[model samples]
Each structure stands twice: as C-alpha cells, then as structure tokens.
Target: MNEKKSVTRLDSTYMDQYDAHVERQGRKKKRLLRRLALFALLTLIVTSSLAIYHVQQRMVYAEKKEEYEQLQEEMGSLKESEENLREEIELLNEEEYVLEIARSNYFFSKEGEIIFKLPNEEPSY
Candidate 1:
C-alpha cells in the first residue's frame, strides 16, 4: 500500500474575500425567497376572504328579496281586507241595514209586524 502525502491548503486574502462574497449572495437569495413566499400567502388570504364575503352578501340579498316579496303579498291582501271592511262600515252606517239584521236574526218587530220561522231543509215533492 502506497502511503499518500496530505497536502495542506494555504489560506490567502483573496480566497477569504471570495468566500465572504459567496456567503452574502446566498443570504440575499434566501431573503428574496422568504419575501416572495410571504407575499404569496398574504395574497391568498385576501382573495379567499373576499370570495367568502361576496358569497355571504349574495345569500343575504336573496333572503331579503324573498322577504320583500312576502311583505308585498301581505300588503295586497291587507288592502283587499281594508276595502271590504270599509264597504261593510258604509252599509252599517245606514239605518235600514241595522234594522234588517235585527229583524232577521233577533226576531225584532216593527209596529203590526208578524214573524214566521221555517226549516231550512229542501222539501221533495
């Protein structure tokens, strides 16, 4: 077996400067990569939050639209009911309508008036 002689490397000023320059370049590259990754993460979070907000707003709008339509239908029915009640009030304001209702339902009689009641069944001949 031939024994190999270990040649010692001599450290020079130029070699030291080159090593420092290489180390600085490596650190700069690592910093640039970290900044890029952080920027990408922030952009993803903002876009996802915006998308969720948009969906929620759309859902709220749909629910409000449905509620509005239901309210509009209720308003229409209430108006019809109000008109019917107003007509009834006008009829009841006359003395004749109250007299007729009392005479038919409560057996009320005017002077020399006779009352007769008949069954409400249909007769077959």
Candidate 2:
C-alpha cells in the first residue's frame, strides 16, 4: 500500500498541471470554434431567406408588369374601337351618308332616282 501511494504521488507532477492547463486551453479553443461555426450558419440561413424573399418579390413584380402591359394594349384597342364607333355615328347623322348606304346596300331609289348595284368581276378572296 505504501509503494502504490508513492507511485500515485509521483504521477501527480508539474507535467500533470501543465497538461491540465493545455486541456483547458484546448476546450476554450473548441468552444470559440463552435460559436464561430454557429454564427456562420445563422448568417447563411438569414442570407438565404433574404434571397428567397427578393426572388419572390421579383416574380410578383414581373407578373404585375406583364398584366399592366396587357391592360394597356387592351385599353388602346378599346379606345381605337370607340373612336371608330364615334366616326360611324357621325357619318350616320349625315343625309348624304345615309343615302349612299341605302342606295348601295338596299338598292333604294327616290322617285326620279335609279340605283344599280353591279357585281364585281374580280373574286373577293
């Protein structure tokens, strides 16, 4: 028992204290590395989320822009059609225009008037 106790005391040397100090330093380094890795991971997650959000907004903006262009085209067509209708209405209010349409379409004639609708010799198609 005395020999074993002497041997154990010999093992507890200055080297053991130095080894303990080295182990504590290694633990602190590992902890710091773990914290850095965790920070980098969180930063990556936040950056990825922002990128996804920006892509979604761009998609929405592109869709809205296409819709706006289509509406503008439709609006232009509608305005052109309205103008054509207004011109037709104006022409219909004229007596000469009414007479011409009646003569051409219905072959109408006045008491002394004669309407002749000659067929075209050329094919329409």
Candidate 3:
C-alpha cells in the first residue's frame, strides 16, 4: 500500500508539471503573435503614407510642368510682338514712312493735289 501511494503521488506531480509547461508555451506563442500583428500594422500605415505622398508629388509636378509650358508659349509670342514693335519704331524714324502714314490716316495731300473719297462696297447680307 505504501509503494502504491508513492507512485500515485509521483504520477500526479508529473502531470502537474506537464500542464504548467504547456500553459507557459501557450502564453509565449500568444505574445509572439501579438508582436507580429503590431509590427505588420505599423508597416502598413507607413507604406500607405509614403504612397500618398508620392502621388501628391506627381500631381504637383504635372501642374508645374503645364504651367512651365504655358509660360514658354507666352514668352515666344511676346518676343514676336517685341520684334514687330521694334520694326515699327524703325519705320517711324524714316521721313517718307512718316509722310505716308500722315497722308493715309489724316488725308493730308501735297500742295495742288485733288483728294477723292471712295466708299467701300459691301454685300448686304
């Protein structure tokens, strides 16, 4: 009877130890899983923010590029107008050109010239 009781006690103690070890292992696994989930969530948030930033930068770049192209076109037109104005200034410096403009715009004729006013014919649409 004494031997049987001692064997039974040993068996019970072994079972208790096994149960405790299983509980510890389970807790460790749960902690590791929680850490992994937190890390994954952080990674997702960071990547999403970076993606959004890049998209915004691309949009801004497109708008700026369009503005630059428009400015280039405007500058080209302004340069052409400046050339035309410079030509007109040069022509105005000539005496003959000035007299021509005065006769055409002000209807001034040389001393003994007969002036005729003609009406323009238009289609009565």
Model 2: per-residue Cα lDDT over 2-51, one tens digit each: 56543444566797998899999999999999999999999999999999
RMSD of 2: 6.6
What total of clashing residue pairs does each candidate reach? 0, 0, 0
TM-score of 2: 0.67
> Using TM-score as the measure, which candidate wins?
1
Candidate 1 TM-score versus the reference = 0.78
Give the TM-score ranking, best first: 1, 3, 2
Error of 3 at 54 (Å): 0.9
**Model 3 misplaced regions, further than 4 Å:** 1-22, 122-125
Output the worst ten-in-a-row residue range by lDDT, candidate 1.
7-16
**TM-scores vs. true structure, each candidate:** 0.78, 0.67, 0.74
lDDT, candidate 2, equals: 0.93
- For residues 10-119, write the lDDT of model 3, one tens digit per residue: 55887899989999999999999999999999999999999999999999999999999999999999999999999999999999999999988899999999788777
Of 2 and 3, the candidate ahead on lDDT is 3
What TM-score, to 2 decimals, does candidate 3 have? 0.74
lDDT for 121 in candidate 1 is 88
